[model samples]
Target chain A: MVIERASVTANELIAEGIFQMNVSAPKIAGENPSPGQFINISVIDSWFHPLRRPMSIAGREGESLKIIYKIFGAGTRLLSEFPVGSFIDLLGPLGNTFELTEGATPVLVGGGVGLAPILWFDETLRSNGIDHTTIIGARHSGEHFLEHCPKEGFILTTDDGTVGIKGTVLPTIESICLEMENPKLFACGPEPMLKAVKQFAEKETVLCELSVESYMGCATGICQGCAIEHKSSSISEHSYHERFSLVCLDGPIYNAKDIRFP
Target chain B: MSCNLTVEIAGVSFKNPIFVASGTFGYGLETQELTDSSSLGAVITKSITRHPREGNPPPRIVETPSGMINSIGLANMGVERYIDTVIPRIDEIGTAVITNIAGFSIDDYLYVMEKLEACKAPICGYEINISCPNVEAGRMEFAVDPELTGRLTESLREVTKKLLIIKLSPNVTGIASIALAAEQAGADAVSAINTVFGMSIDTQSRSPYVQTNVGGLSGPAVRPVGIACVYKISRKVNIPIIGIGGITSANDAVEYILAGASVVQVGTANYKNADTARSMIDELELYLAENGIENLSELTGGVIPNE
Candidate 1:
């Protein structure tokens, strides 16, 4: 999993602060980055911090892969300024791939910027021809990616009723689950939202998977920088694994049951 | 035909000189699915102490202007458990496995080395890490003072017959003196230029970026300083120098080798690029081949006199 130096083929200002950059790397794009798998984009020339920001692959368009991101900090600001044709290093297709259960209807839930991973997952589910529904939520209507959703079976929610339903995506999911029996949930969002969804679902009936976020270094699972603590009863005699699991290696994606969300 | 890039540091001969730094490499076994460990010069395991450490709390790392600040707190599986679990698995890799030992006391250092020496695995060498700042004691403090560095190096030297390479702290005032002291204390080699102490502050929180207040800085921000330390230490000591800091490209590595480093380790670069070490090896070979240099040994301090 070498970090290949990728050149930005196109940088388009998609919306207000958000910019979509397409990088030219067929080998990495062809690596078949599944849903929930992220590419760590090196922000600036030499500045390492904000360490490498993990950007979910927005969509694959030919040889170039798209990353839709907002300018949050110095790292993202630098990333936004990456002139077209400039080289940016990328450590990819890193982290565990999202599990695809056979013949299971996936209810993709994404909130705010967390919607990044769900877009890829939606594409995956569509390709597999698995019946799926998406519940996308944002703080307000302006932040919604309603246009990006697949043509069929999509639900939209916003904090304010300027556009979709006037609540979080959880309410929409709750309503959907009540109507649909035994729907598999695949979610990536803020911890509170994911935890709420996990608690709402019947453990046996609904197999839920969630992608957790953490600060990372050595995105290739070398540095234990991005580790999440898992509650396990069985303690190993060795000193390594009494508590935490690395987010970079063990998973960016884990069985919703395995994680003890904070 | 190009020659194989092999070098000897602290009496341990590596098939190449591009070993991963302690913390950045994790345990060699973790990367088996991603990389070919056998192709590396050596896989230096994360710093192991006498007991298992849980490491620091959240926000262990933050990115700086051109580097990253890390306060990892030297998290490891303790020496005994590492030998029991990690060493056995590493032996299967067949390449040189260097155990990086970090301790809070002289006894802790000795105990770890004694345990590692007893392992059935072909323990290539012991990289004595006296540079970890996150630890409250027995780390950067030992290397800050030349006499303390010498005493600690001597104590560990007495217990382990295996090759001893003291990893020197760059945070110290006189890095060359520390390197010289380690060499005088019977250390087989000295690894110069560990992380420089630095911190980033969060504007919103109005406090330090890392919970541990201060952290070690590594990346391109520290390359010039690393190269300077290697050049200065290489001039002061005859023992081989394993230069490490912000080596990202082959040119960065070449600069260190020409600065008199016999070998170099890629640390922060590995975080940016997983195949940094192998790519560096390839780039170095290409540089040598292009320059008509026959052997890597010829490049050690190969920098021509500026005059």
Candidate 2:
């Protein structure tokens, strides 16, 4: 990972409280970044705060990168207020990337703000000439981010029934898997939604990988801030060789079977 | 005008007087992509014990407004595996090394030391970590009393002829007495002020945030505690002091040095900026140059005492 000052080319409101920022960073744009890798962004002119906000790479457009940030706290709120053509500090592309598999039908599922990273994953699958299915959900109608997404072969769900199906993503997940011949599961969302997807994939004997949204510190693995418990015998196979792994280092992306949920 | 930022402690010279504090930098392998480890004065490895520890449960770290509290519980890959696997990686970095040793008992420490002695890794010194706040063992207990601190330092003194620097805990009544004890027991230098004791509770969950109920607090919030400790301990012992607390910039380092710390360690600030130590080193040089000072040693103990 390298630290670079990225200039904001476009910062627009895609949804309420959620802003899509397109930045021109040669250092980040120069790398072959996969889905699920993130950038740790610092609020401009805010030195009192001692932590950076971790924003996932929404998509990549030639020499520019896209990040969808939610106005959660002071740091992010300040970040949303920055005018276009301003330089912002970003330490990226930090963390491990998602493994793209061939010959298997890539199934992209996400809920709420977790759909941010899935957007990039969708772009990658399409650019590789791979046929895929996209499943998305959010809290309500206006909260969903479906901008510029392909309309065909898409399933939409929401909690309040204002958009599509009046249910959670878990119930719709099973029927979607049954229709596909060779389904590969990839999901990112709330904790309960991720757990549901993991169980569905395991029960159906399908491969599943999850991008967890755990709180982070350095995003570089030193702070040990984003640690999650894992099944002891799971991650020992890889070079990580640890019982517990940092979300920033070992993964923001983990195989569904490898981690032990609390 | 030459700005001399290097410092010599216990016959070992450091490139600068800033180090990435233990627990912040994990064995120097984790942050290699972010910053060059060799740029700092000396790299201190995370606390290594005899056996592998899995550390604490989930929610290990929580960040407050100004600082953070961590209860990692000294989880590490045992000394044998460390000397076998980790040492080779650290040895490749072209910088001086100091292995921070943390154990529950004296033998646990001695066993780690004995194993390290046989290893060919070029570890420059051993910073005796008798003051880790996250563990529920006798490690922090050793620094609470002067006699215990003295005996532990003296025992390790018999084991290795290498440089020995005792790191002090801030959760003590008389920190000066503990420093004096370590110095009298043949310690080469002392690291003043480990993390102070603290805890946080989640109001919505109605339970402790960290599994251990309490943890070590670091960052700018703990800087005052560290400055006071360095001021008190410097008068009691003549050993060089490595001040570690909430050092973020050159100004924080100046406060510690003026308070009689020979050098300083950057801890919690590293979480936000991976190269806090390296940046602080450059800032120190700039400060020296701006003040028309040639030697960095002139800042140490420059604070005036009110008569």
Candidate 3:
């Protein structure tokens, strides 16, 4: 992990309230970051915005990395206002990455801003000459981020019927799971969608890895702020401290079987 | 202009007067890759208990306007594992290490102290944590009650000749008396003002943001409260005062020194920038040089009030 002062090369809105920012972060980008790792960004160095917002790396090319974020709070709103050529402090590429199995049919699912890591994973698989299925979900057609996604082998779904499929990504995921052998699910999204995916993966006995999201402090595991509950009472092999899995250290990526959601 | 940043706390001399507060810099090894830890005067490890604790459930922390509330609940690897894993590697850090010990009972604290004292890891001292508000066992009772604080310090004081510093909380009516009690009972120093009790609500859910309902608040928002506590405690205790709470830069550290702290620990600021405390050593030297002060200690309680 490293702290780099990355300059914003581009920041553009791709969908409703969603933005894609490209930064010139040689230090972090040079680390060969895998999917599911993230960069903690500090927009303003003031008490008003004390903690850095953790944004997953959507894509990376040489010395440049891409981050997709939604303008949900003051921290992100300030991030959206940073003009090109401005500098932002980055602490990353932190957290563990998604594990890809050799010969396992990959099924990638993403919802809302959680699509960042999935898109990166999709591109990684494609580059490796691996065939995979991709699903992107948003509330409606206007909220979908398709510009950054590949044109082929992608399924677009929206809650409303204004998009390709008028439902969540679960149905498409189920169909892919049924058709493929040794299918491995890689997913990121809201809690509800993840829980649904977890249930489906467990019933079908498919391997599943999830990229989690949480409000973090120190992103380096010093603060012990970002915590998620694990399934086991005894410490799992993945846990560093105890029962709660630190999202920053042990994961921002976890196997769905190891974590429990309410 | 030359200045000395060295400070002597309880007979242990530190290269500089800046130390990373406990709990903020986990074990001091977690950030070695991101920042240089050896340059720090001292590294205070997170509070270690007699047994391993799982801590509270998820949603353990939340950011406020200019601060954050954390209810980590003292989740630690226990004293035995800490000594086994972290102590043997202490020399690698190339700086003094002070293990912060926390427990539910007097024996619990003594157990940790004895274990640490018997070790040969060159630990600087012990920072007795009696101010954790997240746990239900004591609920910071030792910090609020002077008698309990005196007893806890006196018991641990008997077990070791090393530096004994009692961490104090700000959620009390008489913080000075607590510091005085620890001093009278043989505490070598007192680190004033752990997090102030605070809470934040999520409007959409209309409930507490942290799972523990209320946690300790630390950041720039609590700097004045910490400075006031240090000043009040400095008046009653003869031992050195180590100030901690929301210190980000040399200016904030200087404020604590002027208010009566012999040294300052970077707390919430470490979360934002782990290098803040280490960098403050240079900044502090520059501060003393520019102000025509030859020694950094000369600024302790230097604040002048208009009568």
Candidate 4:
């Protein structure tokens, strides 16, 4: 991984509390970071906030990287206030990337800022002339960003009846999988939501890939702080201890069958 | 005149005095690409146990005011895998390497130590980790009691002729007594202090932030505690002191040296910047030169008191 000063190219509020930040980081971009990989951004220069914040790559262009984040705490609040031309120390292209298998139609599922990686994955598939479906869920219309995505094969859902379907993303995922042949699932979101998706895919015996999230101390695998439990029956290559996988090194992207919610 | 950063601990020479604390730098391979880890005086590998441990359940870590609380529960790949996967590549680090051993019992520690002794890796010494607070097996019992600390140190000292350093915890009532016990029991040096026991609660959920409810705290918040422990232990023991706890800058390292620490380790700050310890090497030398000091060892226990 490389640490570089990535200057803010743009930071725009796409939804109520969500923002899409663009930075010019040739050093990180030169490594050819893929979808599902993340960059740990150093927040304010203070002792209180010592650890860097890990943000997934939402998109990438020539030498620019895009990150979508919601202001959940003091760190993100400060990140939102960075004016254009300001530089942020970034350490990346970290963790494993999403695996796209041949003959399997990709079905991307996301919610909130978790949609960042999914959006990038959708763009990647489209650019490759590959066929895929995108499903997004949010709390309300004010929390959704449909305009930023392609109109075709992109579905949006809301918890309240302010958008496409008045429910969670599970029903749409089920319906889409029932009709498609060789459907492989790709998902990312808050822990509870990802757990739900994991369970749904496992009951149906469908192949699924999930981008997990955790409170990381060192996004470089030194601290061993981010622990994701291993599924007892599943064989894993990265489970050195035989029971846990560190999200920073083993994955942010994992085959759902290899991991279990703990 | 030039400043010398090299330090000799128990007859083992280090290129500098900036060592990356155990459990913070992993096997010294995690951040090789981000920083020149070879620039460090030494690297202490994570605590290796007899059997591979899965560690504790999440959320394992949470950030507090100026520090963070962590209950990793000594999660590691066990001693066998460490030797199989890490030891052969250990020389790539290009610095003095000290292996940190943690176990639930004296036998467990000896078992791992004996195995390492047979491997013939370029390890200069062993840092006995009897201070990890997150695990239940040992409950860090050896760190709190001087007699227990002495017994553990004495047992491990008989196994190897290499340098032996006892890592002390600040969560005890008499930390100096424990350090003295290790020194009397044949420990070559002592490192103080490990993390301070701490906890945090979330008001909204009315629950602890970390799953373990309590964890070991390390960061800028614990720097004073570390310095105090080092000063106290230095007064009690004649052996060299390795100061650890939230050390981030050369200025901080100097403070530890003044308090009687022969060397310092960068802990939580490594998370903020992996290159922290490597950068401090030059900064520390510059510090000595600017002050007209020729040797860093002279600064150890150099704190002046008011008349």
Candidate 5:
């Protein structure tokens, strides 16, 4: 992927603390950016904020790509202050893309800010004329942000019973999984929810792919900042010593069963 | 008028003074799609040892306010594997390639160098990686001791006809004396400050951020210490010094150059931008051109001390 100095075309709050920014990243957003990969972005002229914070690619419209992020650290805190005409430096389309088979029915699942990456996943499925279902959950009604998505075949859940469902995405996922035949799942969200989704997907015997968010230094492969452990690797299934993989290189997405979530 | 960024250190000429620090840039192949590798002065391969290394466990790096600490434990394939698979790709980079060697003892260092001497690639020289703070043995152990540093440099000087540059650790009390020991042992040049020893704990988790609690800290956090080492060593010895620590922009490179470094390697900044080394090369040249400076050799050791 290329490092592009994409101008900030639009930056506004979508939910309580979540923001959706449209950036002019032609090469980085690419003609067809796969769903799971993300962008490492930072404030235009701030060398003080040295590391580029990783943001999931929410959507791509025409010449610009959309990024959905929460103000978690110093980098994001600085980015929230940029005006509409300002520029945001980005290095991306990094990490591996979500894998979809030719005929596996798509089932999109997202939780909180994790839904950002899956927004692109849902769009890709819709564009491919694939019939799929979307299940999104947030902490409360104010945190919910899928108003622009289609009403039919969509499930929304909130913790305080202010949205589509009162509980987490787990119930909606179970019911949907039971209905859809040979559904292939794509999910990104909180660790606890991902753990539940992984369990649900496993029990239901459907294919599952997940994206994990780890604290990072370099979104590239060089710095071993973002590494996730696995039960087994390609080199060894039972080898105790080498059970690790880099989130920046091997994946931001892996099969539901491929990784053991903490 | 065209600017000449060419620099000759230890009888080896670099297209510029921008060498990518060992390990931070990872053999320089990953960023080929982002920028041309041949643009930088040189690409120093990751530190390699006699046997393969798995490195430290998970959480190898942690982000500080302005920099990062990594206990990457010289995580790399053995020397033979690197020479067979990675070096050829490095050979194609068409720029100066300096192999950074790491070992537990001088014999381990000698063994790796012997194998390196056999390789027919157009390698300009070797940078002895005696300064890494990530490992439990050999790296810092050899670097902190002036005698060990001298003996290693002296033995390495016996083998191979290539230029020898000793990388010094900043963990020692007297950075200058260790550098002098290296100079006396016949090193072509010395690269200062290979990460100051550091550690950070995740309070909430009640554990160390990295599996190995103590790692080598790099980036802008270590910049002053690195410059100080270069400055201190510059006075004690006359050999060229390759200043490394946390160099982000051209001004930082010039800071090291003014402090008496003939060359500078950009380390932790590469994490922020993969093309940092190339960008710094362009920035340094522009700084020279705009300032009406004809050559870069004049800037080396330009800093004047106060009486």
Candidate 6:
């Protein structure tokens, strides 16, 4: 609740234009922002605009929290430009957490900036001693940076034929499906990718949890800025299509079956 | 010691004066775990309409100097769905539930208000939104024209006996004249200064920063402007003024009340800190008690004129 201005103790360019920064927020890290939960990092020093940039918790090192971000626009670009010691205001441990399934084989899928969530997922599964398989995909080889991929079954794919596989990660997933036993797919990526995975994956046998992105005002549930429709059976029973849920409140994570995407 | 902070708006009293703004608070249900809803005066629901809205495209929000720009498109479930799913859960909180209604037309407003009237929750009042920018018609038309403002208020007055508060836009040229029109039209109160229309551009890309090209700006940058508007309108109208805009602290709320706001709404502040309004109200009560003030009304319009 206390929005603090923490300093960036270290900044590393993990990939070209992609930076991973550790911020000094012992209190925040101690509180433990859950996987799939995000933090709002202030874009600039002044209070000209009230909203904060929502970023996923990459991993938490001792006495600090890690945020992996790519320089996309003014906010991210400005964020990347912050010197190591500059103070950055943050509002965090926000939104709902990814519901961890007990004794389930976790398959983590990430694409581009969406990779941030999976990183936390990997750390969480590792800590819990849950076996997880991470499949990461990028546009090409230049963008494929999976060095931080935890010691689990790692699958890499690129859109261009420059990496492990030539086609999409979905194809790689299908191939893996033939070899691996019943695995729960946890995916966060572009909508098309998630949709493709959702369409192909076995819905009943495989529990799929997805992280979605939307235009938001308050990263918190207020504002109704980030809402996703939830299909209801009662509406179908009544011969009406009724659904309701908010991404900021209900989840940035949802069972793949529950989401009715835009 | 317990922090006793309570304030009243209209005839409905609040446990505290820190109520979340209409669009920012969504329904109280969304933030159940983040903050205690019962601790505040009221939770204003997201702006509801006769029909559901998908809202604007990507990049709906952009960060400004000390504030942020948002074009959230006032997305929400239709009134019927809201009453069924959202309202029933509100009573558990004990805090007053204020519903915000928006429409594409006067008829749409009347329909939504009628639906809200049917809800069982303690609908203390209605905040009629006539200034949301993301919508194509309806809201901006009523807000920009004084005559249209009067008509909308008059229609709302006829349909629902519940106290009506008209939220005015700050984007217009003559906000005072519009506020005067609302008073003439029988509005119970007026909440001012929605987001100011603005945009930020990415120099390198030669494109608008937000996907929506332009959005409404809120935060500290707009606080002074909000205070100025509240002061001007409070002087012009007899109705109690509910000040909103860039209020983030107890001093900001105090400044608005001193400028003539009977109550204040915390919007963008909630985004920055979920407990902002409650903390602000606590701070305000402490300031009042320390100064030996008993009632908040004593500080309303307390500003001294320059000699």
Docking quality level of the chain pair in candidate 3: medium
Q: Quote model 5's TM-score.
A: 0.92
Per-residue lDDT tens digits for candidate 1, residues A1-262, read: 5467898888877655667888997778778776788888878755455367888777776667878787887788888888998998887877787776776667889876777788778887788777889888877767764653435777778788766777888878887766776677888888888888888764445788888888888776667676666767774653464567778778898888787754
Fnat for candidate 2 (0 to 1): 0.45
Cα deviation of B260 in candidate 4 (Å)? Answer: 0.8
RMSD of candidate 2 to true structure, Å: 2.7
Question: Residues A43-119, candidate 3, lDDT per residue (tens digit)?
Answer: 89776778999999999999999999999888999999999999999988999999988889889999999999999
Cα distance off (Å), candidate 2, residue A225: 2.7
Task: Locate the minimum summed-lDDT window of 10 residues in model 3 chain B.
Answer: B132-141
Query: Taking the tens digit of each residue's C-alpha lDDT, what string does model 1 give over B116-198?
Result: 77664577778988864324452447878888789889998888777888998888778999999999999999887789989
TM-scores, all candidates, are: 0.84, 0.93, 0.97, 0.96, 0.92, 0.76
Clashing pairs in 4: none
lDDT (Cα, tens digit) per residue for candidate 4, span B159-278? 999989999999899999999999999999999988899999999999898899989999999999999999888889899999999898999999999999999999999998889888
Model 4 segments more than 4 A misplaced: A148-151, A234-240, B132-140
TM-score of chain B of each: 0.95, 0.95, 0.97, 0.97, 0.95, 0.94
Per-model C-alpha RMSD: 4.0, 2.7, 2.2, 2.3, 2.8, 5.4
Q: Put the candidates in TM-score order, highest first.
A: 3, 4, 2, 5, 1, 6
Calculate DockQ per candidate and list them. Answer: 0.41, 0.44, 0.62, 0.60, 0.42, 0.33
Which tens-of-lDDT digit does each residue in B1-307 have in candidate 5? 5677899986788989998998877766777777777888988888878887666667788777677778776767778887888877875677899988988877888999999887865688899988643244433588888888898899999997798999988888898999999999999999998888888888888887777888888888889999988999998999999999889899999999999998899888888887888888878888998987778988999988787
Candidate 5 stretches with Cα past 4 Å from truth are A147-151, A231-242, B1-4, B132-140, B289-292
User: lDDT tens digits, residues B184-234, model 6?
Assistant: 999988899888888998888888866678888888889889999999997
By DockQ, the better pick of 4 and 6 is: 4
Name the lDDT value of residue B196 in candidate 3.
Answer: 89
Clash count for candidate 2 is 0
Cα lDDT tens digits, model 5, A1-262, are 7888888988989898998889888878564567788888766364565677888888887778988888876677778877898887888888888887777877888998899988788888788777888888997889987652436667788888887887888888888888877888889999999999899888878899999887777777777667677666454422312466678887899887978754
Model 5 lDDT vs. the true structure? 0.82
Segments of candidate 2 deviating more than 4 angstroms? A44-47, A147-151, A234-241, B89-91, B132-140
lDDT, candidate 5, residue A80? 82
lDDT of 2 by residue, B1-307 (tens): 6799889898888888888788788787777777778888888888888888777777787766677778877877879888988888875556888899998777878889989987856788899889642244433588898887888899999988888999999998999999999999999999978888889888889888777888888888889899999999988989899999989999999999999998888887877777878887778888899999888888888889899
